[model samples]
Target chain A: MSWMHTIFALILLPAIATGMFRILRGPTAADRMMTAQLFGTCGVAILLLLSTGMGNPVLLDIALVFALLAALATITFVRRTWHGSNKRNHGNPL
Target chain B: MIYSILTLFDIILILTMLWLAWCLLNTEDIFKAVVLFISFGLLMALAWVRMRAPDVALAEAALGAGLTGPLFLSALRRMNRTRKGERRLDSDENREKEHKANQEQG
Candidate 1:
């Protein structure tokens, strides 16, 4: 792995560590959820860095999978948290 | 220098995971716990990558963090709804009891 890639990947660790505080202390579900989203994005970035740093194309594929899954997860969150099964029951959401 | 940096990263990642796990386990709020658990999953995935295991990292991100986090939150919301329903029922029962007591007194 080249120094540049190593540096790039190393930078994300502190960022992730910082995100943990919000997860621990967030006042609302939405705040915590946003930090969770941050994790997905940061994970994607770190994986990309690792793929390029290690010169392994397979890691890129893994990162792509993470990206897709992360989007799906976020969509699931939005659907459940905001648009839950309420619309079907005469607009009364529980 | 890179070796030292990587080792330092390993330490930080592990510590972060431990602290997040503690927070997840100790929080009174279920929603906060779910979020911390998800963050812990992400950190574990990163640790996998550091160990040169992209396959494990991929699985961790998909199943551990991404998929599980929202499911936990939704389940919590459902629990909240049930608790609210129980509270409403309890309040109605109390009202009925009060009515009965007033009728006996009168």
Candidate 2:
């Protein structure tokens, strides 16, 4: 049973590894962002698997935190790159 | 069989980590580097799991990969803005210098 859980977690790693290739070879910023998004989701899944396999509940909270903050990078990207750059485009009045 | 599988998994995880870290350091673009860095964190979290360290995995997933990706992007933006500001300052100084030269000639 425990080995099953371990194998499950181990199997998911290849997906993340593929995502790393995307990050390495990405031509656009958005591609990289998408890959990071993959990281968040996959990380959560891996954490859940480990948590259950090890019979440690604390890992669940970490997974929850991962889910919550997953979009934080996107938010910052939008605010800093898109919104902040617009200031210069509108002809900075100041 | 299970031990062999576990050993194989550990080998792959270690190789993936080393590959990602190398790519992160060698990548030319700062944005790509940031992305790789996040991936590194996430992979590190996986390694923590294999090593039976849940606490470290949690922190790596949340603070390391999650928050830090955006932080690096913003830092890149801040750098560009400052670079632009410096260029503008240099151009303004050049304009002033040219203006003074014109006045003296006239």
Local distance difference test values of all predictions, in order? 0.75, 0.78
- TM-score of each model, in listed order: 0.78, 0.79
lDDT of 2 by residue, A5-38 (tens): 7688788978888777777777767777888888
Candidate 1 lDDT tens digits, A1-94: 6557767887887898898777767776567778888887887887788677766777787678777877665676668754663543545665
lDDT of 1 at B39: 76
Clashes of each: 0, 0
Off-target runs (Cα >4 Å) in candidate 1 are: A82-94, B86-106
Number of the top candidate by lDDT?
2
Quote the true-contact fraction of every model: 0.58, 0.73
All models, RMSD in angstroms: 7.4, 6.4
